[model samples]
Target: MPSRWLLSILTLILASAIVVACNGDNENTETSGKETDGGKPDDFVTLKMIMPGDESARMREFVDNELNDRLKNDLNMKLELTYIPWGSYQQKLELSLSTGEDYDLFWHGTPFVSGYKSKGYIQPLDELLQKYGQNLIKNIPAENFKLDQIDGKQWAIPSQAFTSAGKFTSVMVRQDLLESVGMTEIRTIADLEAFYRKMHAIDPSYYGYLETDRGHEVLWRELSGENLTAFDERNLFAVNEDTGELVNYVESDLYKKVAHLREDWVKKGIIDKNLVGNPQSKIDQENAGKLLFRVGAVSRAMENLQTAQKADSGAKLREYFLAPDKPRYIVAPSNEAYMIPAAAKHAERAMMFMNWILKSKDNYNFIIFGVEGKYYRIENGKIKLLTNDQLMYEWMWRNKNYFTAPTNVPDDVVRDMLHNDDNAKISRLFGFHFNEEPVKKEMAQVLTVYKEKFDLINSGLVGYNSGFSSAMTALKKAGYDKVFAELKKQFNEFNAGRP
Candidate 1:
């Protein structure tokens, strides 16, 4: 309670800081009204974008003093980016979209665009692309654009900038703990459980034996060796890649297998019963050198290793890919995106600005890596990032063609990240967009049920037998059948139509 209270206090302070900084920037928008080539200043459009993360005076200065100054001359457009702390991002994002006060568009994260589209907060970008985003269509592959499309209409610019070679889940274990247990590697579920047991015996005070930021069902599916693609996220619904059958993943035996495994780990004192929401808890513990394991993808492990080293210089962590025998699937380039609000006052300018960013490799790289000398520099053909925080929200604009890895990164990472999605298990539904429009209310209610009942079950706090049945019953009452039916119908048609 005390920690939550303190967090709440900090959230308010950060929110207030963001508001104050935004106000100052708004009053300081002298550059947003820069003159055009023919001396028409009205041609300049200032696109307002809302983002997540705390206010950074450094970033504000870089955008206004440097980035915007260049944009005023080249594209005749400017950007007004506002930050809302992660704690209050969704709430504030929805509020801004609902009100349309000082907001043109905002970041659209995965598993969220569906909800936003259902609520009519964001608009279709089909016409916008035809008119102003032509450069985007020319540069970005058609398959990549489908990531942000639903009902065959693009709702936002795709957020993938990596090679999209494919996505596979991996685990990061504390090497110190492994060596302490006289173990070298963990490649099996049995090995994982044994490692946890020995680690718990040494220090039961450690949180959970495993903590993952990735979707639970997807992670477990990889471990279970199931041929299922959780297209709807969090194992709410899935399509069997082999059979093309759509069904409720939660109701499948695969769900029961992993749930029971997690429960067993919990019973054996390997998993913490007091599971917290989100991967941020794991991040917090890792910073304090208390976390035992972290799970996500290969890139996630790489990022985790960097953060762990900063948290503890002596920290020894090793990354291992789960289900190594199976191919990693590429569903989309990335799950990050930015969507234009339907009520955006400058929708055309928003499209033009984004299109301009992708018009050239140099332009894209400049936006991401920042000034060549200050934020980054190339040494021996490799980029050296001087400040990681200069543009912390640069993930939203990742373009594989323009991506340059820092010197600290491994060459294989750079190679894999920049490649096309050909070498890996590309999903049959790679370009298939699931529309929740027909069953919006049902999906919402079922998702609410999932949050309330399934979070604990998925976290391994309780055995599947203890609560899984009741949750299924609740889901059925919440119209899970309708969702499943709709998904099945769509997947069948999509699969049949695919070449």
Candidate 2:
């Protein structure tokens, strides 16, 4: 009924309308793919995280079924984990980062922090943390965050554990051995020594102390109350509490006393001679129920007690602070932290994951303990572990502030040690981080000298004064003076800037 021209115009109009309508539909679909809450679409991201430990098959299953399901539904992301054994962790991490591997996150510690930051292997987290890590900022204290900063930029987010302000050193003694020795309590180092001597005297076959090469270093730190600064990589330097001057920790009076005591103990048959080079001997003795006293961290004490109980039902354990009179707590620079490499493609997503983990109790608990009904169960407001077979490595993503207490330790004991109000004295040099750049060469030379010379003195194989003099002479020859001067200058600068 219409004219030919009118019919042609109508056909063009319909075609234009269809094209505009299709364009509108495409725009709507694209917008829908992005979430309004800043999250991505389902299955849009797969994050790779490398951690230190053997990968648990059970954990992998749970993550695939339980964790990924939730992450996919909520954040549109999933996690891929690569576990490296402790011995191979450092080497593998270096290799992975150097090769520009596509990793989103990894566990970091003190030894790696300075090196990683200085070399620009990791990115500053200031903006990412501000945008997505509000929960972390709220939960962790501002001062605690200062520990992760290098040159005024944050490179890592510290795990929610006792970083630098908790009781670390404690002596766990065998209760049955103490009772046999007629000792009720060990209040001081002298009391402990007496107990050890009595145990040895009662039974010549029983060793008084099971000493380990690394345990001795912790004991020395507890006794000296001096933090190992950058200049003291070998832990041979201490700051004078009175004058704040740098002093050789091995040459100090306290160190001399402890070293002499160790020497006397070694001669008196209190310490096993094989312990000097054989660190595993301590573990062997502990399992054999021959260990009388062991010095280590509070959690280690608890773990030892558990191990001792499993070995001998009659075994009982008691803990005591080595320096109860002057409780010294060093806020450690690193515990457990999540770091994003500079080459990571999913930096924002990694931070989002961290923020979500910190913010959600269910998420954190799931990561820490595993699937609630399967791996653990709640009993009377405490977590009762169901099986140790496929346990989540707590240190990998633990937040002690919101952690649930395990059944292996009493709730009260966990609270007392974790919230150690009585002995929560922050060190005078609490937040000081030693820049290793200035003295890198000196540090390497000194470390070699320390292992060759100072380790003997520390292990009580050599006399204190003679070994100290010899080690000091070697250190001086290795340019110890230069290292000390640089450290002192830095310390002064840090002190001047302290608020």
- Quick one: best TM-score, which candidate? 1
Clash pairs detected, candidate 1: 161-398, 163-417
TM-score of 1: 0.81
How displaced is residue 173 in candidate 2, in Å? Answer: 3.9
Residues 296-319, model 1: lDDT tens digits: 444554445455666665656665
Model 2 segments beyond 4 Å from truth? 1-43, 91-102, 161-166, 174-184, 194-233, 268-293, 302-318, 389-392, 395-401
Q: Write model 2 residue lDDT over 431-456, tens digit each, in one string.
A: 56678788889967977887788777
Candidates' C-alpha lDDT = 0.66, 0.65
Candidate 2 structure lDDT: 0.65
